[model samples]
Every structure is written in structure tokens, then in C-alpha cells.
Target: DGGGVRGLSSLLILENLMHRLSPEKDILPCNVFRLIGGTSTGGIIAIMLGRLGMSVKDCITAYHSLSRDIFDGPWRPKAWQTSKKVLGLTGDAELRSRRLEEAICHIIARYLPAEEKSALFGEEEIDPCKTPICRVFVVATQQSNGRRVILRNYPIPYEASRDMTIVEACLATSAAPFVFAPLTAGPEGCRETYIDGGLGNNNPVAIVLQESRLLWPRQSVKSLVSIGTGARVPTEVKQNLMSLAKKVAEMIVDAANEARDFESNIRLTEPSIHSVYFRLDVAESMARIGLAEWRMLGAIAQRTRSWIFENHDLLNRCVVTLGGILLNCLCITLRYLSKC
Candidate 1:
């Protein structure tokens, strides 16, 4: 899930899990998880961990740095400017999209190999067919058709061709509505504009499940972890027009309840996999924070820590199960090497 700067909560939760998995040393999630998918800010997290192969701690640090850089300037436009932009008289955004693109490019450059440096925004591909270490994808909503598109680092048969560069994929997925301009990408004469995937897929648990089934049709999923960016206070629906507008805006901004609904569906429909499915989300004090409140990092961290302490038992079980999965993967790889 993506909640602008609130994504810090997701990172904090993953950090706790990584610590529990390997207390003495750093264990990269890319080595343990087969596929990782995310949307909007969560998409950024997916790239940092799955595509760049960063440790959770390092990813947290990098997230802090880039968020500061991307959201450093004034984020709200003047009343007149906002009115004009909203009325379609202007296309300017309050925040500079270039800042976001540059920050993402810098991070990608730091991790990419020297030989692939020149292909940062060109023909460089990010797919399991090319780099089998970990499969990663970011979700985006196509503006023209209002359909969900997966910018994958792995190929899926019969899906749209995976010809976009890593930088383009990151840009498309992170293009939040109104906050940043939508990205127009693809080959000439076939371009499509893309906005944030959070419009309908703020919680991408369903996408992850569907994509996993497509990737491994015969194999049953062993573990599925759905991390969320803290929960929000539920709002009551009102009959007044102003209240209805407010409610609609809130729904567009954050889809906290959707995450819970998806979890419930998983448990009800697939009872057998329920034991292996883990959903970690902080439960209190997050509703007061705004999505773009970057200065509230301290409060976010504190809340996440408290939540972790409170749910120690649940986290421990998740860690133990993940550890077992890692061990099994190691054994399978060793057996294949022996056969070779």
C-alpha cells in the first residue's frame, strides 16, 4: 500500500521482520522472497528491495533521503493556481515531477552495474528472464482506459510487452494524481499516460495473488506477506453534499479498509493458506497524520515500534515460518547444483 510519506510505516514493519529473521546479520528479502509487488509509494519500496536488492535498513535510509529530496519544496499551490489547475486551464502540479524522476534515477544508478549505467532510461530491461535473482513489479493505472497495468521485472505470457526501462516503470508507478504530472510512456504512436495505481489498487494484495498464480500455475503459494501503511479511523457516511465530497476525497487518498477486506477474503476463501498469510499494520494514532506529512517521521517510527512490541508473538511466528522457507530454498538450490 502507498500513503505518500506514510510508507515509512511499511518499511518499519519490514525492518522488524528482517531483524527477527536474522538478528545477528543482515538478510536481504530479495534472497528469500520469489516475487514482490507494490503500488505508488509501495512501488518505490518494491524497487528498492526487490529490484535493487537493498537490505531493509538501507532501504529505510534511502527512502528517508529521497522523500526529503522529492518533497522538499512547497507542495501546495496558491488558491487561484489550484483553481485554474483543477478547471483544466493549467496542467502544472504543485510539486516538481523532475525532482521525483531524478531521485529515482540516482538510486537506480547507485545499484546498477557499471556496464548497464548508460542504459538507465533506455533499453535496459528488468525482468526474471534477464535477472532471475528476484522478480519485481510496480502497479500503475493507465489514464486512457482506466485499467491496471503491471510494470514487471518479469514477463507474463499474453500480457503487454515489457519493453519499458526501469526508470520509466518507476516514474509511471509513482505518478500520484494532482501531486505530480502523469507520465506518458511507450514506443512512438503507442504511448499511454499513467497515474498512481492507488486509484483502485491502493492495497495490491489481490494483484500479488493474481500475478503469483499466473507465474506459478501448478505450485501452491507457501507464504504471502501483506504489509500496510498503518490504519485510519473509519468515517461515517453523511447525506450532505459537502460530507459526500469529503468522503469521496478520503477514499481516493487512502484505502486502508480495503487491505482488511482483502485479508478477510483470503482467510475465508483459502483456509489452508491462511496460516501462512500475514498482514502487518499499525493500529492506532495514524489517522491523525496526513499522507504527505514528511515531518512526522519520528511519530511514525514510534508508533510502528510500539505496534511491533504489542504484536511480538505474531511476528515471531511469521519469522519462524519464513526462516523455514528460506532453508528449504537453500536445500533445493544445493540439490540442483549437485545434479549439475
Candidate 2:
């Protein structure tokens, strides 16, 4: 029903009443008071808002505290059990790795467009160390923990290139000490960035990153205003932007940290501990990278012949004895288990 002259007041009461009646168990009900203040609100409001959002966000923080309470959670359904049934009969390590990658890919697809998959600019997306001289390095972080560890390793020989600048638009998306190859500026020197994806045909998007540079578009202003024609970038607005940037920076660092810890845990739990050295086996990795180079190939061949001469036996094979045993210890016991 419409109120006569007091329509705004009636609407406000109704809205406030509804908010008050929302279930209390939701932990966080919407904070509507923020909208009530006039446009002249101080920078503190924006700062508080940034802090509030950061506090509410799910940062993958690791807590080593122990508790005696029983921990119980949800179980998987029949669909997952069926997938495991098929997975159990497979003995190929490559197949297992592919399957795991595929599952992760499924989730990635829902969020990202097709082009931004793991295969962009080589596998070492964010390697800390510089590459071999004569090529470019790329640091595209897929997912990360708080501050450390670039988790993927592509078998590629990095011949470093010269003249690189570590470019980051906002504090949040900045890389840690430049593991990736330095970003060489475009021929034009500086870029005119558009607000969103829209621009000319070649908009020149930066890489799909773990965190976005959320620099909001500045409001348009015109000199010699006629009542409401223009407004400059106020001091408060700039302060708010700074606050937001800081919060985002914290989130990015936390994401990198989480990814770091997860990779470490995966290495510790690997079926073969030797898999730990799989990335760093320079001889084997070099052979993989330079498979096409005849000179490198010959070098690897000579090395292989030398190794063979040193050891007489073949690289022995282990047959799969546990036939079609679809067992998942996830259903049994594991102290650490939580939904992402």
C-alpha cells in the first residue's frame, strides 16, 4: 500500500522491520545502515567498510591449535563413489594425474573462461628464480596461499630475455619479489586502461590473475558546473581507494600462503617420496625440455648411455597386484578434512 506524504518513512520502517526479522542464526545479517549516511560521509566510513569486508572474508589461515572436541562433517554421495570405482582399476600414474587435473579443471571452467586454463605462458607461472639467459619468464598464478610458493612446474627450459619490469596495477595483485619473467612494456610505453573488459578491438588485458586490480573508475567531472554538472576526486574518495587496496593486498597474500601450504602437504603425502625430486631432476627435466634440440638430445643420449654403463639392470617395473580394489581411506580416517 502507498502512503500519502510520509511514503519514504513508511518504506523505511517496513525495510528495517524485515531486516530485523531475518533469522538470527545466519551469523551475518546484512548491514543496511551504511546506506543511510549522506554522500558527504568521511573517509573513515569507507575504511571501516573495507575492514569489515576483509574481516568477513574467508582467508585460508592456518591454525595449529589443538582441541579435544569431536570433528564430524558431510560425506560424499554415490556419484563420487562411482568415480572412485573407475579410478581404482587404473594403474597408470599419468592417468591418475590427468584425472586429478581434469576434476580441478571442471571447477576452473565454471569460474574462468576457456582461454585462462593452466596452459598459458609455460608451466612455471610464478617461479621466484630467474630463468636461463635469452628468453622471457611468466608468472601467472592460478591459485595461491598467503605469501609464498608458486605451485606448478611445467617442463620447459627457461632461456631468459632482457628488459623486464614487474608490473602490478594494485597492491593486492603484486607478485612476490618477481619469480615470473619481467613484464616488458608495450611499444606505446604506457597503456590507457578501460573501466571493464570493453575497449577497442585489442583491449590489451593483463593476464588472468589470482586477484584482480579493483581500481574503481573515477567519476566524470566538468569545469564550470551548472548546479550538478561536475565534481572532482574528493580526498575522502582517494583515502577509501587506499583502504580497499590494502585489504585486497592482504587477501592476495593469504591466498598465496594457502596454496603454498597445500602443495607442501601434497608432497608429504605423495605415495612415493621420490616424487618430491621429480621437478628438480635437472637431467631428466632437461631431456624433456630439449627433446626437439638434436644437440641437447645427443647430450642426454650420451648421459643415458653413461648411466646405463654404470648400472647393468633395467629400470624395473612393478605390476599392479591389488586388482580392482576400490578402497577410499577418505571414508575411514584422516585428521585433516574440510570443505574448501
Pick by TM-score: which candidate is best?
1
Q: Could you tell me every candidate's TM-score relative to the true structure?
A: 0.88, 0.17
Candidate 2 residue 280 C-alpha distance from true site, Å: 17
Counting clashing residue pairs in each candidate, in order, gives 1, 23
Candidate 2: which stretches are off by over 4 Å?
Answer: 1-184, 188-246, 259-261, 268-340
Put down candidate 1 lDDT per residue, 121-173, tens digits, no spaces: 22334432345456788889999898988888766777655577777777788
Scored by CA lDDT, what does every candidate get? 0.77, 0.21
User: Which predicted model would earn the best lDDT?
Assistant: 1
TM-score of 2: 0.17
Model 2: ten consecutive residues of lowest lDDT: 59-68
